[model samples]
Target: MKNSTCLLQPSLATTVALPVIYSFLFPAGSIGNILAAWIFSRQALTKRTQYIYLVNLVSANLLICSTMPFLTVYFARGYQWTYNSVPCGIVNYLGTLIMHVNMYVTIMILSSIALSQYATLKKNSDAQYSQAGNENCQRFLLKKFRQPKFAKYLCIIIWLTVLCVTVIAITRNARARTMEESPRCYNIRVEAGELGAMVLATGCFFLSFMMVLLSYYSLTRHLSEIQRNTCIEEKHLIYRTVKRNIFVIQMILTVCFLPYHIFRPIFYVMLTNNDCPRLNYLVEIKNFLTCLAAAKSSLDPVITLLLDKTFKKSLCGLFTRSTSEQHKRNPDIFIEESPDT
Candidate 1:
């Protein structure tokens, strides 16, 4: 029964699902990420930090997406790995590296944004507290807290650390491949160096999660302190901002990514152990959730468009002008409604 179970693992099902997943994602994710990259690239210098992180995110997404075609073809060929050993090593290495980088960059960006919000709130709170003491004190504190220099340095350090780890993982994976006669191509031997590589990747994942959680906790704590002592209006605004930001971040991590991570280890264990039929259902669900998580990258631009007032206004104005032009060209067919009504 154990042998049967091992043999029955859903390798074929996974292969069959690959192209379908790729088809769904390529148009929506690949295209959307590219458009976002283009839009962010054109923004002014003041928009550099957020936009630069976004560009990195988009670039990583593109790199990941670019591999889908190769993957689709590989899987469509029945997971036979006909692309030769070098291409196989390169593809697997690049794909995994990009995936890790994307995950880390996203976490870093969110932490940076959260830290920015926290700093802003802290400065404002300090200024108000100072004003309560004396107007001159408030002005002096405001000048002193005009910028948070450490935030930029912190972001750069996070990026560099993640980049170094990703490069190391890719180099290790590439170096570890060996040809297998049955598979007809080079593959990482799970019992050998691949195990170490997997451990490193898992460590990186946990570290990223830990950093994000800590940053989130700190931000929340600072906000709570500010809220406790501030004026009613300022307190309300700060609370709302903090609540919204926390909700968005939590939704992104828990709703989108947590399920995949939670199930990944379980799936790995099931594959290593004799594959239980029950595990197959869990694996299917995990794959679906992973696809949903990947979709989040594609949906991020849309989320910004909906949530950001400035972006919403720009989109609305563009659409309104286009509609008005259409109405002018065909007055009898398209009638405008009066705002008074």
Candidate 2:
């Protein structure tokens, strides 16, 4: 059983080949998240609830990536079981917990942001649509979540549910371990009979994916309406930035995250159905997909800044503060000041 479970551990070759996948990601994720946090600290971002979610999402990614060093050790050490499994289990558990929070919070934040943008665009589209009863619904959502109390309670609920799911996953993995494998560090080895949990995850993933798509669709529709009804080309710079950000969000969900989500149900279902469950090739594919999943932690900050113009501009300001400050000084001060004195 120990050896069989070790089969779930990635081979030395795979780990070696993918060192950058772990090592490079950790620093990039850490720096990106830290910068995002700094950007959020600006007073301008304080008003919106989506900024709160964005900060927490960045935090979750940071926490998840912090465990990469442990994973790096495991991978770099020829995939051998060396350290105490307790810490390994801990890192493993945290990795999953943060991953879950990151995914759902991203869906929640980005979709709401897009929806808010849609509402804004709709309000400016035409007098007819802006005055309609349907506009009230949009306006209500925009304001409802803007309230700190409402957004705070909702965020607490989300974190609590995430904690519950993580505990369950850790408990399940713990209960399945035999004496031999109980004390060894290894890769994520899922066996049969995690379908209920997987189903829940699958449901959440699909629902979030659909919501994101719907929000983007509504946003684009309103944007088009605004263009037709107003001078879009004149204000196209503003719209263009938002559109680019939305495009990056779509790409992240589709390119980085889609495969793992799409394959998760099928992988578990197949494992449950097969009596032996000895598909080496499938395990390799799972590792590859999981690497892509791991990349999300690094990519998320990039996504956040890519999507948020204000945050990007704020971050840029921090780096060039001295230059900006110099520009603020009187240009004449540098022109023969000694002669004037």
Candidate 3:
């Protein structure tokens, strides 16, 4: 076992950029999630089971957002904190725990949404093809994914599985690395199990990523065939909505998640080998990418707005009310004075 000191100091970018990035993420993510929660509150979950997944996604995002201020302070203070301090441990552990939960939970929920949307599209296609009202066996299995009870159970399973795995991994890793503590909170050493866990998580992420890609491709193909065969505007619109939802899910994974998972294994390798000089720079880069992943929480509300009709209605109504109030306060501004006649 290599008894490495905490040689991973923050670079100028890590110190400056992390705090700034997380400072922005905090308020943005908080407001977005709060709005999503409020909007979701008004709707019945049983009527729209996909909202179950979205609500869970928003919950995960909110959990991570709550940790942002502590993280921002930790990074801003040049990554310096007494290793044995209670506060330091709480911040470090919660930050790590919530971040991993957010990443993996987001991955699972979005994958579920994509798969559900694809299943819905296929159901529509089957009807269009006049399959004598016969349900394909595979479609029947996926159809369960769209049901309220199944979605609820699935969300519960996802939360429990992710939380248990993350907690176990963090605890074991911390126990293995706690000898001769470094004065920095983020200076964690990689153990063999941690590396294995990282690789496993990365593999899962890629698998989900590929699933989203396949769903998108399948949707596009179906949409094209439908457009060519029939000019039914309603079918076209339905296909478009499903396609856009899948596309947005793909974009979120690509922008927020791809970089971090891509770099994580390489970072673990470097950290384990103790390439002291280069490892410092790599840590900084890894942290920035991690921030990007966390920023997806801030982006989840936008996803909710796009994907949920009820949420969109609520948001639009809120905006309309705010505008009405503004106009009420100043009627002359809206009247425009007839453009000076």
TM-score of each: 0.69, 0.76, 0.85
Please provide, for model 3 over 1-341, each residue's C-alpha lDDT reduced to its tens digit, 9 standing for 90 to 100: 13566456677787787889899989999999998888677654324556677778888889889989878877876356666666666766676656776678889888988887787667657666653445577676767766767778898898889878877867775675466465655565421125667777899899999999998997788677777777768556667777888898899999989998888887777766666677777777887888888888888888676666556665776867644344234311000111110
What lDDT would each prediction earn against the true structure? 0.52, 0.58, 0.72
lDDT digits (tens) for residues 50-135 of candidate 2:
56556666766776677677656555553455324555555455544445545655555555545444444444444334433456
Q: What range of 10 consecutive residues in model 3 has the weakest lDDT sum?
A: 332-341
Scored against the true structure, residue 226 in model 2 reaches a CA lDDT of 67
Where model 1 places Cα greater than 4 Å from the true spot, the runs are 1-13, 45-49, 82-87, 130-159, 179-230, 269-271, 274-289, 316-341
Task: Please give the lDDT score for candidate 2.
Answer: 0.58
lDDT of 1 by residue, 165-272 (tens): 777766665554433332522122321124454465456556655655665675567566655766557356544655566456656766777776676666555555
Rank all candidate structures by their TM-score, best first, as comma-separated numbers.
3, 2, 1
Candidate 2 total steric clashes: 0
| Rank list by lDDT | 3, 2, 1
Best by lDDT: 3
